[model samples]
Target: MKKILLVALAFATVQFSSAQVETPQPSPASKMEQKVGLTDVTVNYSRPGVKGRTIFGDLVPYGKVWRTGANKNTTISFSDDVMIGGKELKAGEYALFTKPNAGSWDIYFYTDTNNWGAPRKWDDAKVALTTTAKVEKLPFNVETFMILITNIKTNGASLEFVWENVMVEVPFTVPTDKKAVANIEKVMAGPSANDYFDSATFYYDNGKDINKAKMWIEKAVELSDKPRFWYIHTQALIYKKAGDKKAAKKAAERSLALAKEAKYDAYIKKNEDLLKTL
Candidate 1:
């Protein structure tokens, strides 16, 4: 029993010694979220202090690809597709890399994000964008690294970085107007054939008003210049459920013909099954 207790005490001591203690990091992790127009922009990075050391052109090294922050490679994510310096970037997460110079900083939006600081091998093709941002010398130093969405507008914003005594910014535009205008036109023009078909099917499936579903399905078929087989099949089902046997039979036949032409075996089988029941 004494031996067993001694062994257990040793195990506990080893576990206690091996256990990690929580402490503050030299460069703390930080996350920032901002909305650039309709787009949701997010930044995940580590902020390292100047610590009274020389930045840019010295410690950071000029004309070298930097991680843009400490620890993990800094990442930025966009919810909507955006335009930077008239160049379009698809909506996704990107590693933020930079090459700082005396007068300017070459900013990079890299496609690859999973890395510690800088990537082992830098591939030019992985760079989504490379834009030069002019560095503005500040009167006073900014001790900690800072990134802010400055110059906010309805359609765009500036991604400003501040560290040491320098500040650089890259301007990006979001397609708020294009998206909004398209949505407005769609709503103004009226519900599309697919919209009617979807509504009709939803009503039919949910055991809603069968007559209303019949009307919507009829409108869907009429509005379609060349109505799809699946649309017609749904229409047939809706009509049958609405107790319109003649309309159901005609719609099923039309659906069967369209399905055969389109080589859609599933819709053809569905139409044939529906017709037998009718």
Candidate 2:
């Protein structure tokens, strides 16, 4: 009986030792990542120490500019033109930096290529954009630096930043449809006109006003015969809508001729079929 009891005691001790020796599973960390633009350029970075640990002046140092976060310089690339910090940034990558304070912070955009360090040498930067942030009046400590984009719209967006007892917001605007249209028209009026014609066709396919569509197609037709098929097809549809059978037939024939020359056999066949009914 004594030997059996000793054997059971030894087994319990081994089980407790095994439990203590077991390796602990690591807790997952949330990394910052976002996507932007038509091609969906991915932006990713690590969020380092923030609130409870003490940042800026205590952990990060106040007077010096910080790289903002660790691992890869907090890159943001635009697939197209974007207005950031009230200034236009063309499609490219930029390194982010910040000047921190208790009340407000100055956000900076560095054009420097190497994103390894913070403000090592600002003289090499191409340009810098400054924006002010409004700090909150709360005593919550942040453990990780963070950024979020909210209230996104076609015309503009709000870029937000948060850390420790503060939050900053910057309003950013993208090119509006009206502005794009005006710019396209200006480009069309330039020396090489076909480029503009292509632009008009793009706008039309995207559901622009029919009257504007008709006007742009007319401009395309006047510029060169290269877009003749598109212009003729559009004019034929317009004529059909206006109940002008004679004009519709003429335009359809023109479209068929242009399509045939361009080896657009499918377009030629479709336009010819429509012409037969007229």
Candidate 3:
């Protein structure tokens, strides 16, 4: 019994020692996601507090590359291609690194995203983009590092980084105008059959000119190889509103036949109701 008790106690001690406990991190992981124009941008980093230390010159040290954030390297991801600092960056994830100075900061988007800290050996080949941003002093102190995307516009935004008493802004633009203009051109070129059908339906429902409604519905039917039952029903409604009883009855019968073939019970009932009205 004594041997068994000792073994059980030892096992309990091992179990206690092996148990994992959760605790707050000194520099906690953070994430930010924003959409600028048609591009989706995401940032993941760890925020380290100032903790009463001088950040720029003393701890971070100017004229040398620094990991943009704490612990694991900072990462920025873009869903679509973007123009930053007059250079185009392709859609992908990048490791963000910075070399700070008194007047300006050099920002680097590196292809390598798996580094723990600033890459020990600098490789120019790994750099996807390099840009410079002017630094500005803030009036008040900031306790922790922060990254903000602000000055949002339809096609661009400002990516700002703030820490201690300094801030830097990087301007980026997304190519949204090309796609927008293409869509506009496509829409201006011509309307689809569905567009014609919807226009006719709207005109008929709003008690507009019956002749115009009939004209649009006829175009819709001509566009469709085999017109839907709803299209024929809409034509019947337009004819009925125009006081053409024969034409209305003929269109309603066509709609009923198509509706029956499609096994559309609701449309079949609608046709039956419309025929009764005629």
Q: What C-alpha lDDT do the candidate models reach, one value each?
A: 0.93, 0.66, 0.93
Model 1 local distance difference test score? 0.93
Model 2 over residues 1-278: C-alpha lDDT tens digits?
Answer: 99999999999999988885546323212344434322223344556655356665677676567666665566655566777766777767677777777667777767774767574567634655666776565577655567776666667666676666656777666666656687789878683446545665665567656566556656667777465686678677656655678988988998999899999988898798879889
Model 3 agreement with the true structure over 55-98: per-residue lDDT tens digits:
99889999999898899889999888899988999999999999
Considering summed lDDT, which 10 consecutive residues are worst modelled in model 1? 226-235
Clash tally, candidates in order: 0, 5, 0
**What's each prediction's TM-score?**
0.84, 0.50, 0.65
**Candidates 2 and 3 compared by TM-score, better number:** 3
Best model number under TM-score: 1
Candidate with better TM-score, 1 vs 2: 1
> What is candidate 2's CA lDDT for residue 155?
72
**What stretches of model 2 exceed 4 Å from their correct place?**
1-42, 178-278
Segments in model 1 whose C-alpha atoms lie over 4 Å from true places:
1-20, 224-226, 257-269
Clashing pairs in 1: none
Off by over 4 Å in 3: 182-278
